[model samples]
Target chain A: MNSAISVRHLTKDFRIGIRGLKLRAVDDLSLEIPRGQVYGLLGPNGCGKSTTLKVVLGLVSATAGEISILGEPSATSAARRRTGFLPEAPYFHKFLTGRELVRYCAQLSGVAASDLDAAVEDALGLAAMKEAAGRPIGTYSKGMLQRIGFAQAVVHDPELIILDEPTAGVDPVGSASIGRMIHAMRDKGKTVVLCSHLLGQVEQVCDRVAIMDRGKLVLEGAVEDVLSRRDRHVMTIEAMTPAARTAAEAALEAHGAKITSVTHPRRSLEDLFRELVTGSRDA
Target chain B: MKDSLRRTLWISRVTFLEAVRQRFFAFLLVLSAAMVLSSVSLRVFDFGHGELKFIADFGFGGMFFFGSVLAVVMTAQLFFSEIDNKTALTLLAKPLSRPEFLLGKFFGAWAVLGVFVLVLASLQGVVLWAREQELIAAAEQAGRIPTTFSIVGLCQLVLLQWLRLGVVIAIVLAISSLARTFLFTVVVGSLAVVAGQLQWIAQDAFLRPTDSPAYAAFLWISTRLIPNLQQFNLADALVLGSSAVEEGALIAVCLSGLAYLVAYLTLGSLIFRQREI
Candidate 1:
């Protein structure tokens, strides 16, 4: 149970055209995602990340290998009962209000009648969707849709939540909103597996990350362990004159260290955008 | 088991809402209603049949034709809309099984068809009753017997037509589970409807002496597999009293429709279980 999701030697092949030419979507992929952490699955458009998620959620069958969720077989209802998934570019029935859609998903996910109202309200509140919950889903913006999608995914209060490209087409504010939701899930000791192409958000939200390419796992490790370079250091100093800079460089050289590069530290564009646009357009 | 059924019901509820909201369902319904209403003006061209029989035939024709179209096109659209819109991805990822999802679609589409049949039958019943009243008045003046439509028989016909549409929906769903595109499913589903309507011919041939075992086997399978949709077209006998239909015969037709409906739904469920969402 320490591993939230265990995928062993997973491979998926799809047939194409009339001849049924085999296309390998996942190539011998194996992963052991731990519990109570935010894990990011990163890859390009066709790198099998979504396919792997689909297999783990049992939406698609694996051509080979075994996958289990919380010590139960992935395809079993018992396993799925404890799992929630929000798919990429999510679409819901347009006629339903956001609240109705969330409530509908809650019922399908087996929320008891006694707790259904509370659970739906809690999830909608967490996604910041309570304001627009009464409106039809067709009226939702991209950000609102993602938020409501997030609400539906968590309404069941599952132990493990899988989100595939949760913020793919959303703005920075919406993306940040989803990030906070993921952090909140982790804080609640729930395992959250995120699949995304936004590396910056992934870096900010995920504790561990696995990168795939050409249907193979290329890298997997703790984000801090893989990203941080122990051999180099960076420091930001304010109001440094040329003389002070030369003096600092000489001091570092005398200590057997060299100033490899000198540059000013700047904020990321996403951070800048979020700061300039303080309020969400959807709000 | 209760939870599974509850989940299935939820899916069906949403699906029913979605199908009803479609413009296509509304369009076919309006068109069918117009046909049923217009049967009065068109009664003169009944080819020498009684006025009530002509009106009954007209209404039944509208129901049979438009109901089949709605069942075929709407069921396929209902199923494919989910897949194409990727809503199925969100739904199938839950604890729901493929059979539950398929059955939900079936029930939802069937519910819409039920509404269609009910509306047309009610309107047809009104028209038939009104025409019968006028005919009875004229015949009483001339000392001649007048024809009247049977209320009980109309209700029975409504149920029969609803069951027939249910079978069509089930057949379309099974085809959709195997077919890749909506157009493909509709084409094949329409063909299946046509086959079912003509299945009595296959039964007739099967009962007669056959030449080859292979042909006989084909006929046997066709007769068993394709339901005789014509048997449900007893509007003349049941509604207009052109002939009397035995109670046992009506029950047999109903049982046959139910059997086909179940068989097709089971086949669809099994096929959908293996489908890659």
Candidate 2:
């Protein structure tokens, strides 16, 4: 099967102001996003990650090159029908209950009428928003908003899902919940393209990652391939007294090797926060 | 075709729900109802016209003025709010076409206007009927003829006003598609309404044998592009049976309004398709 998404030499130039000055947002960017894995598109603010996603999803027209989603030409209704998108900082009508909004999106996405109830309930459950589905969106907190947005995106059971800044402004507990939802999607054989600045979460959940800077692709590789340092080695030994440490250093010296700095492996603050504040509610 | 219509209806359904919940809609409904009810108390000042005619005219004037404001400002606000808030980014990213989105907005706004017009017209009708009954009793007792109104004519006028506002909403949507600010679309849309009200002048000039071809061509285009909003302003003649309206004339006016509505909506959709989210 082909990759979930494919972009070749894609470029985007936006005309700004009354004079129509060209502003290059994405420049000659190419990437092949594989299927059924959690992939992260990461960059600093205004680095064109969102722009690239928009172009792939057909929200913004590309200035040059070609792109496709699920082996079909991008921007066609067929392609979009199999794809789902949740934009950054999603805003829905305040008058609608959470279930109503998700049901509305499901109908727009062409979900079958007979299966709509099951689809909506399943999606809400996945996002852990089932308990609050009947409340009007105006009363939702930031975490609840993101959860509802997730439910809406997945309600139609699309093959591929693109989430931009899903964890923005969300607390650690909320962010962890989202990470779990992404994992659930991946386990279900659905391709998930995540765009976020939360590097720790990205490192933990993403199987492959692409980093962009200044409208250009700076790095793309499997997480293990890119993160592993082959030139260095580490050895952790328990009950090593001073004499044993000296012997280890002496053996390395005899073999023309040197002992560098030693440090213990430590978990990240995010992991620690998730551990300590595991039961905290967004309310 | 079925899918497209379904999508448009979904958009319209949501848009209608959003619009009806606005404080602005409620505020205007109340204000217009007040105008209709107060017309009964102010019937003595009749301006030499019959009491029922004066009351109907006052109510129709309120509906026209407030309805225009709602059509121009509220429609622009609704369209731009999606863009400004980035909700369009989510909806348009779906399989929904730009035209579907535009048409949805049109129907939604039109539906709201339909409600507005129906409520005020019904209230005005009741007020007129009550006053007509009293006047008929007085006239019968004094051996004079009683003034009356036509319910069918009032319904026809309501349909015409709704179509007129639909045209206005379409024009404003086209402007909103191209405009960068909500205020700009409202200003230009209001100006367009004013120009459309005066479009009959251009139509008259075009009919005359002018020496300047360029001026004639300009007036010709203006007359065709700007709908003659005055044609829909037959409230007194239609509602009070003051004058006879030709069958073909009513159909022609309706067809013209529909043409303008479709043309502007197409133009707006084309422009919106190229816009970057």
List each candidate's DockQ score.
Answer: 0.89, 0.85
Pairs of residues at least 3 apart in sequence or in different chains that clash in candidate 1: none
Question: In order, what lDDT does every prediction score?
Answer: 0.93, 0.92
Best by DockQ: 1
TM-score of each: 0.99, 0.98
Q: How big is the positional error of residue B182 in model 1, measured in Å on the Cα after superposition? A: 0.3
In candidate 2 chain B, where is summed lDDT lowest over 10 consecutive residues?
Answer: B86-95
In candidate 2, which residue ranges exceed 4 Å CA deviation? Answer: none
- lDDT agreement of model 2 with the native: 0.92
- Indicate the residue-level lDDT of B199 in model 2: 93
- Superposed Cα deviation of residue A89, candidate 2 (Å): 1.0
Candidate 1, A223-263: lDDT as tens digits? 99999999999898999999999999999999999998999
